[model samples]
Target: MSGSSSTAANLVRTVKVKAEKKVYSLPGQKYAVPEEREPLRIFYESLSKQKPESEMAEFWLMEHGMMSPERAKKAYEKKQKRQKHQRMGTPIKAEISKETSESSRKSSNAKNDQRTKKRSLEYEDSDDDDLIMKPSKAKQK
Candidate 1:
């Protein structure tokens, strides 16, 4: 019953306020509410074109030897310093493994053979310009 009475009182107050506004002139002009700015189309477009930040960070790590940028820079600086020292001592020659040495020798021999064949062709040409002008063999009827 109390809730119903309170609701009735609220309704009467609302009606009174509406009637008062209709009878009396309200003070100040009602300004138009400003329109909201449109969503940023260009920002979305730019974001779509870009690689993901995490992927870019991973690429950056791989580029700098898979280390943190700071650590990579420190390592690079240390290497540069060591190189600048120009320490001279008995040079450590690289040891060629037997398998690698044999493969390399085979490749070298193949290259030499190619060169020899090329030279032989050149020599034949030098010996006679007509060497390459041999008549085609044909069975005479």
Candidate 2:
């Protein structure tokens, strides 16, 4: 029992050490040397630092790495244009053609008539007793 416990302790220690030393790398690259890893680390740091607060900021950041005055102006104009469209009230009734409106109304009326006919037919075929469900004998037992 003592020998077994010692063997387990040694195994646990070995596993812990190995786990601590484990390295992650891309499939083709077994291990990244300092030179290869440096550029990736710098790129990741830049990405982390350059997180934009909004769509406009994102555009500016992407174009110039940091916001430049010209890019900022363009981004601002784009944002304003989008906001203007959103703020515009619903489309005028005149913009929708009379033909489309009439066709839509006719289609909706036909659908409602079909639904009423189906419901009347269903009621005529079904009895009051059929509508009432009784408990199963197997379930009661």
Candidate 3:
């Protein structure tokens, strides 16, 4: 009996939307802000170099109270990747092959199959290159 679409349309809208920036403050107003990625990355690399095969990077973030355990674990993965780049002395980039396109792959596969068929055809009891040979099938007698 109340708030019909027609009646609602007739009345002026009073819905208020909040556009203010939201802030997250801990119980003691402690803000969990992470340090710059570069410095953290450098520190992580140094720490990793000092003690290889240890999960110190995640604990480092936890010790600093910069992020939660879950988030720290994710950041640790990033730390490991960066450390790998540093240890390698060169950043390995993925190489993109031009002939890997969908149409090219299909056309290349078809061409290879056709060439194999033509080669098989030449061995079918004739040295003549002009004759098209059909592949013989085994028929059960």
Q: Candidate 1, residues 1-141: lDDT per residue as tens digits? A: 689988888786433344333321212212222223423333333443473333333323323243445654654554444446647543444456999999999999999999999999898779566556868899899
Q: Compare candidates 1 and 3 on TM-score and give the better one.
A: 1
**Model 2: CA > 4 A from native:** 1-82, 88-94, 129-141
Query: In candidate 1, what residue range of length 10 has the lowest lDDT sum?
Result: 24-33
lDDT of 2: 0.56
TM-score per candidate, in order? 0.30, 0.30, 0.22
Who wins the lDDT comparison? Answer: 3
Per-residue lDDT of 32-124 in model 3, one digit per residue for the tens? 545567687568657766874445654564445455556655655666676799898978554447766777889999999999999888888
Q: Model 3 segments beyond 4 Å from truth? A: 1-63, 92-141
Q: Indicate the TM-score of model 1.
A: 0.30
The C-alpha RMSD of each candidate to the native structure, in angstroms, is 28.6, 17.3, 16.5
By lDDT, the candidates rank as: 3, 2, 1
lDDT, candidate 2, at 62: 32
lDDT for each residue of candidate 2 in 6-61, tens digit (9 for 90 to 100): 88887864333444543432221223333434665455435646853346334434
The local distance difference test score of model 3 is 0.63
Clashes of each: 0, 0, 0
* Candidate no. 3 TM-score: 0.22
